[model samples]
Target: MNKLGRKLSLSISLAVIVIFSISILLTQYFLPKYYLHKTKERLEQVSNEIKKMDKTTFIHSKETIENKYGITIVYEPINSNVDELNEVVFSQLYKKRITLNKFWITEETLQKLAEGKKVNKIYDQGKLKSSFFASFMQRDDMLVLVGNSIVHFSDTAKIVNEFNLYMLLFSIILIIALVWILSKKITTPLKELKDVSKDISELKFETVHIKTNDEIE
Candidate 1:
């Protein structure tokens, strides 16, 4: 490749690298947060729908809700002790025995729920990486708990970065080919001019035919 082709290729490759680097950095910084926000919003919507259901409907539609939203639905008496709430909710949701500390529910969270506020949190402990969203709403004497576990997207981000890497490689190859062709087109006329000057210097005046249809010709 000529000097112009090499320069063009280098400049274009550097630009592509910079752009891809910024894109990957931005994705790493914001994608998880954005995903979490949307997941929480969806869970909140589901919780609202659950809040509107009567006890009979809620119970009857439990399977439908779980299957539709990929969530777990459980309810308990509003008068249940707040301290034991976490255990009850966790057991009902996961159907397993886990320490109370593993659950994200706390006194404050329970208080907010009692006040008819939605609760959302991230649970990342003991091989569990999930976004937990819940709301406690009264349906007669029962407090309906609508909750969901959303898996984190670290693997998805990894796949995206891998795809960007492949795109960068493909773009570099394309840039190199385009730059080579462009440089050759631009320099060909200049090479002919150089030869014409050399012939005139040697007193070899001849009819020179250059028909590039540009100033170089």
Candidate 2:
């Protein structure tokens, strides 16, 4: 009911809101950036190791893009008489629902891959699966298709989303606790003022316990 009490409550609410907003913005920026850098480092490591394999191994063909996520090496050339592995692997990767970028190493794509040139990529978010199919031939007899899954990206996004959700929840709780503690402190001062004012008006100021601290007495 007191003016001091009203002012204190309003100030506390505003400060809490501002602090919470800053927390959300900072976490949103930093957490995702860190996660992306870490993921890129990992994928780069895998891809680089793959490049090494290309140099060392005697090729019946340039190695087909092996499905790296959950699928086992279904048929490495040494074990299988059927080089029909390309067709089978292609069908299975499509079914598993993990496709991000596809480079059909055509004469054009192979040229690009060989030259280490960046291909013009038109990413179709609507049909992400379209990114999965790139056809190639390592040798005349071997058809190599190098493709990736949307799962790698989707998993990254999911993890980042979960992380952001945790940040938001933590910020909310921290702001609430701060506001509660400050609100009580703010009320204590105003309530002191109120009681003092009331006692003065009622002419009981002489016996009033105006000071809260025993140490200050």
lDDT of each: 0.74, 0.45
Those runs of model 1 whose alpha carbons end farther than 4 Å from true positions after fitting are 95-101, 129-131, 153-163, 189-217
- The 10-residue segment with the lowest total lDDT in model 1: 96-105
**lDDT tens per residue, model 1, 2-94:** 999999999999999999998887777788888777777777888778778777888899889878987666787755576676566767767
Give stretches of model 2 more than 4 Å off: 1-41, 53-103, 116-147, 151-185, 189-217
59-94 per-residue lDDT for model 2 (tens digits): 422233343432212112311333355346545455
Error of 1 at 187 (Å): 3.4
Angstrom error of the Cα, residue 102, model 1: value is 1.4
